[model samples]
Target: QISEATDAPEAFVAKILQPLSKKGILISNKGKQGGFTVDLDKIEHIKIIEIILATDGEEIFTRCAFGLEKCSSEKPCPFHFTYKPIREGLKSSLSEISIYDMALKTEQGEAFLKI
Candidate 1:
């Protein structure tokens, strides 16, 4: 259902689900009634940062926006300083946003999962 709704291949969704499940962000069942679900009790404590890190890893927070091999403060790339603050800001925002907040936004039509 998620794959179809997102227009992503089942394999792609499966790959994403594996990491999330391993990280305890998702609960997966493997039977006729099998499906993945989030623990509603814990959902309010699950920040966007946790979901992103579980699925995408730390590279998104560490890698260069311009794809420079060794971009860093010591030997900065062209956009290093400029991108640093933006990345940090995004990280901070994600850390503060819970899945519940996003769900509320989606439910209230203030945000969306697609488009």
Candidate 2:
């Protein structure tokens, strides 16, 4: 839908779609009435973290706070130590959740609706 609507390159669209499909995060249909739709039931089982990591990568939050190479605990960058906790927290939160939790919360009106 995104690709068709946006007129994006097929390769680019495929790149974006493949990972989601492999993770069962997206379902695509074929034929005259074929299209794409989110499997809400399965989606409920996914975590925000998995989606983030799937699309972005686990290192996204921890990649050298200042974009420096070889930043680490022993030879940390000036900002590394300070950024560590924040990065870890973000990563941990993402890795510890599922989409189901989000759906249930949303259904119960316990989750915030984003525009």
lDDT of 2 at 82: 89
| Cα distance off (Å), candidate 2, residue 13 | 9.1
Clashing residue pairs in candidate 1 are none
Which 10 successive residues of model 1 have the least lDDT summed? 1-10
Best by lDDT: 1
lDDT of 1 by residue, 31-113 (tens): 99887899999999999999899988888888998898888999999899999999999999999999999989988999876
**lDDT per residue, candidate 2, 1-115, as tens digits?**
5575457876797677767777778787778986556786576566787777677776788689898889999899999888999988877786667767765776687974442
Q: How many Å off is the CA of 30 in candidate 1?
A: 1.0
Residue pairs in candidate 2 whose N, alpha carbon or C atoms collide under 3 angstroms: 44-99, 44-100, 46-98, 46-99, 47-98, 47-99, 49-94
Q: After superposing candidate 1, which stretches have Cα over 4 Å from the reference?
A: none
- Per-residue error at 55 for model 1, in Å? 1.2
* TM-score computed on alpha carbons, candidate 2: 0.66
lDDT of each: 0.90, 0.75
